[model samples]
Target: MKRSIKRLVAFVFLFLALNNTTAQSIPDSLAQKIDKLFSQWNNPNTPGCAIGVVRNDSLIYAKGYGMANLEYGIPITPETIFHMASVSKQFTAYSIVLLARQGKLRLDDDIHQYLPWFPDLKEKITIRHLLNHTSGIRDQWQLLAIAGTRLDDVITQDHIVKILSKQQALNFKPGEKYSYSNSGFTMLAEIVKAVTGQSLRRFTDSAIFKPLGMKQTHFHDDYTEIEKNRAYSYQRKNLFTFSNSVLSYSNAGATSLFTNINDLSKWVMNFYTPVAGTAADIDQLVQKGKLNNGVELNYALGISSDTYKGYKQYSHSGGDAGFRTYLTVLPELKMGFMVFSNLAEVNTYEKTYQLVDLFIKDTSAKVNADIRMDSSRAIIKDEGRAKNFTGDFISEDGAQFSFVLRNRKLYWERYGNSDLLYPGLKDSFTVARSPEIKFVFSTTPGKSVLVNQYWPDNKRLLVKYATDSIQTDNQLQMYAGLYYCPELDCKYTIVAKDHELILTSNKYNDSKLKLVGKDHLFTDYWWMRHLKTISGNNKKIIGFEVNDGRIMHLRFNKIQ
Candidate 1:
C-alpha cells in the first residue's frame, strides 16, 4: 500500500513537469488561439494541413490539424510529407546560386552558352534573367498544353526541351518585362546539370537539404520512388476524392518538391542562419529582378519580396494537383510561417498570413478610405468628353485595350471581355465588381492614354492607337470552321449563331468571341485574351494562334 501511494505521487509530479514544459514552449492561451483558428480543419474524415511557426530560427509551434490520408484514417502530423509545387523554385534557385559561388557559371552569361541546342531567337537571355523570371520565356505548362499535353500529363524534361526548342519566338525581350515563366526555372535546372554534371535532385540533396538537416526534404524527381509518410493529395469536385498528381516528377526545377513542416522548418532557419551556403550565396538568392527600363521587380531569384501588413515579407505560394502550400519569412523579425496542405480547397495563402498575424503583434493601422462620393458630388458627368475617349490603346508590351461609350456608359474592353466602368471623380472610372481597379483617362487630345490604376506603383499605361470597330457577320463567318492545333493536339470549333461568334474547345467551355481588333479576338476569360487569325496559302483563313500572359503564339490549323 505504501509503494502504490509512492508511485501515484511520482505520476502526479511527472504530469505537472510536462505541463510546465508545454507552458514554457508556448503560452497555453496562445496555443488555444492557434488551435481555434484551424478548428474548422480538425476532422478525421477530411484531408488537411501541417503548419509550423518559427521564432528566431527555432520552430516554436508545430501542429497538424486534420487527416493526412482519409482512406487509411491517418491523421496529419508535422512529419507528413507534401508536394510543394512552385515553392520548389527557391531551392532550384539556390542550386544556381551555389553554382555561381563555385565559379562554374556566371549569372550574366547567356543561357545559350550552357544550352547550345536552344534556339538563339536573337535575344540575349542571361542566367540572371532565368533566375529572376524576367527571361520572358513562355511558360512550359502552357506550351505543353498547346502541344496537346494537359497539365496532369506525365511530362518529362525531354518533352519540355523538345517543345521549347521548336518555339521560334519569345513573349518579350529578356529583362523587358516581369512575367512569371516556369520555363526559365526548368532551364535553370538544365543549366545546373550542364555545369555540375549532376541532376538537380542529386545536387540539392547533398548541398541544401543534407547540410540544412532537412532529412525529409528532397527534389522529388521520380514518382515511382517510394516515400514513407507521404500525404496523398485530394480534390473535391462533387465529393472528396483521392487524386494522384499526374505530373512527371522527373523534372526537378519548376515543381516536383516533397517536404514536411518539420523538415521545412530547418530550411526556413537556414535563411536566417548560414549552414548550406555562404552569406554571399544567400544574397544572390534574394536579389530582385530588374527591367530593361531600370525598374526593379518584386520577384527575386526564386522567391518574391513583398510587404504584409507593414512587415517586409519574403514569401512564395504553390499549387499543383491537390496540393496547396505557403511559406513566408520576415528576416527582420526573425519569424517565419509555413503551411502545407494536401487538399486543394484550403486557402493556404490567406490562412498562412492569418497564422503569421497570430504570432506577430498587430499595429492596429488602417488604410485611409477614399471618399469617391464626396469628391464627385460637385463634378458634372461629361458625356461628350467620355465619347471622345473612345479609341484602341496599346501598351509597350503589345497588350491592347479599347474604350467604348455605349448607352451613356463607358466600357473598358481588353482582348474581347468588356467591363463597364462607372465614373468616379473626373476622367477616372472604377470597375463595379472591382472598385479598387481604376481607369484614369488623359484629357489632352492626341495624348489620350488609359492608365490601369491597379497594383500601386506598378500602374500600366495604354497609349491611344486609333478608333476600333466590331467585326461584320461576313468577316466572322469566313473564319468559322473546325481548327486543329497540331502542337496542342486539340481542336477548336468556331460557330456563328445569332450574329455572334462562339469559340469552343474540348479543354474549356464555350466562350463567345469579342472582336477587339482587325485580327485580334478577346473572350470573357482572361486567359483566352489574345486570339489572332492566321492565314494559309492564297490568304485563305487557315487557323488562329492563342497567346496570352503565359502562352505565346500557339497556332491551330483550319480543318473541316
Candidate 2:
C-alpha cells in the first residue's frame, strides 16, 4: 500500500513539472523577466552583454545592458560592436562550404596539397577534418602559450602559419578522435588564401557579408584598424577595470571577428532562413562529426548540435581576451539567442540559458547557487585499499593526474590542487567535492591494470606510475640542458640544482619539476605540466615532448 501511494505521488509531480515547463508567458512579462535575469549587469558603471532574440525570419527583440566603453561612459546598445571570438567560426566554415560549391576546392583533398609549407605528419588531413576539428592538430593558442608567446604581444596570421608549418606531430591520428584545435581553422583559412589568392576576410566579405547585407560585420584581421562605435573590452581587477584590455590579434579564421548583436542577429537568422547560403549549402553546415571508429560527435562543421528541453538545438560559443560570445539556434521553434559581452567576467553561457528559460517559457525550478548537494549517497571506507590507489597516473589521451594517501584518506591531485576522494563500493571511489565523478580500480589480464575514471564530459582509463625517487644525482644531471622548440620559436633551460630539477625560460618564471616513472615528468607550470623525456638510440636523453592540455607531444629538443 505504501509503494502504491509513492508511485501515485511521483506521477502527479511529473505531470505538474511538464505542465510548468509548457506554460506560456505573455510577451510583455517575458521581456521584463529577461531584463530581470540580467539585472546584475544592468548598471551603467559595469561591462555588460548585448542580447538578440530572433524568431523565425524576424529579430523580435534586441537590447544591451551596462557600458560599452566605461571610460567614455558609452552606453551599450544593440549596435555595439563585440569581438565574437569562436562564434566567428561558423562564418569561416560557411566560407569553405561556399568555396566547395564553386569548385574552388574539394573538402576531401589533403591540406598539404594547397599549403606546401606545412610539414608532413604522415597522415592525410583533409579540408573536412579541419572544418570538423577531428584532424588531431594541436590548438594554436596552446602551442603559442607553451612557446612563451604573450597573447597580447601583437600576434598575426603570418605568425600562426609560421608556427604551424613546423609542427612535428599530431595529437592523434587524423579522424581517430575529435579534439577542438584552432590550428585546424587557421589552416582552413590558409587553404582559402592558397586557392583563391584572397584572404579569409576578403573572400568572406564578398561571399557572405555582402549577400546578407551585414555591413557592420567583418573579420578584424588588423587589430590596428579601428571601427566606429566599437566597445572597448575590459578585464576585472581589484585596482579598477579600465585600461586592462590589451589584445592585439591581426588574424582571421579562428578568431578576430568584430560584430554587433544587430549584425549577429542576421547571422543567427541565416542558419534557419535563406539569408547567407543556398538551401543545399545550409544543409552541410549542421552535419555532425564522426570518428573513424563510427562514434558520432556533437561537434558539427564549426557548430555543435544537441538537444535542450526536448527541442533540437545548434550552438557555438567563443571567448578571447576580455570578450565572450554565445550563439544558439533552436530550429524546431525557429528561435535563436545571442549574447555578446566585453568583460571577461561576463558569463555569456549562463545568460543565454536564463534568456532561454524566459523567452522559451521554461518551467524548471531554479537551482540554489550557494549550495552544492549531491543526491542521497554514502561512501564505504578502508585504509589499506585507499593507499593502494595512491600514485601518479596518466590517461591514454595524455591527461595526467595523481592520487595521494593523506591522513588515512585518498585524495585526487592535479596541477597543485587536491580533492578529497570518498570511498565507495569495492575498488570504487567518488570525489568528495564533485560526487558526479567516479573512479574504479581493477587489475586486467596480462599487462594492464586500469583506473577507470568517469567524469562529466569523458571516461578515461588511467594507469598508475611511480615517482622518480629511485633516480640518483647522476641520473638527474642527464636531464639538465638548454632546449629549443622550432615550432614555437621559444627556448627553455632545464636546470639541476642540488639533485632537484627546475625549468627556466626567458619569458616565464622557473617551475620546479617532479620526475615520474621512467621518462615522464610533472610540473606546476601550466604549459610544462606533463613532459616525457625523448631518448636517443644510444640511451642518452635527447629532448622532451610537452602535453599542455590542448596541445600534445610538442617536441622541445636539447640545444646544449
Model 2 per-residue lDDT tens digits across residues 1-560: 99998787566544532321112223777767877877777766678878888887677877777778887767677888888899888888988898888898898899989989999989999989998898988888878878788788899999998888878889888887778899888888888899899999999889899888889989999989979988888888765444557788999999988888777777777777866678788778888878787777888889998777677788999998889999999887889988888888888999898888776654335655454534333333566756667788887445778887766667789998988776777688888777789999887675445799986444677887755568788888999999988767788898989878998888888888887666777777765688888899998999998865677778889989
**Which numbered prediction scores highest in lDDT against the true structure?**
2
How far residue 522's Cα lies from its native spot in candidate 1, in Å, is 5.6
RMSD, candidate 1, Å: 7.4
Q: How well is each residue in 1-560 modelled by candidate 1, as lDDT tens digits?
A: 99997787566534532332111267889878877778777655567788888888678888887777776766777878888999999999999999888899999999999998788899899999988888878888777764556676677888888887877678778887777888988899999999989999899999999998899888888777888988887887556454544444567799989998878888887777879998787777888888887787889999998677777778999998788999998877878899888888889998898888787775547765553433333233777877767877765334877888776777779877987777876678877555778877775565555565554224566666544466678877987899886754668788988888998877776889876545666766555566877776787787787767776566777887
Off by over 4 Å in 1: 1-24, 239-248, 363-383, 390-476, 482-530, 534-542, 557-560
Alpha-carbon RMSD of each model: 7.4, 11.5
User: Number of clashes in every candidate structure?
Assistant: 6, 0
lDDT of 2 at 97: 90
**Candidate-wise lDDT, in order:** 0.78, 0.81
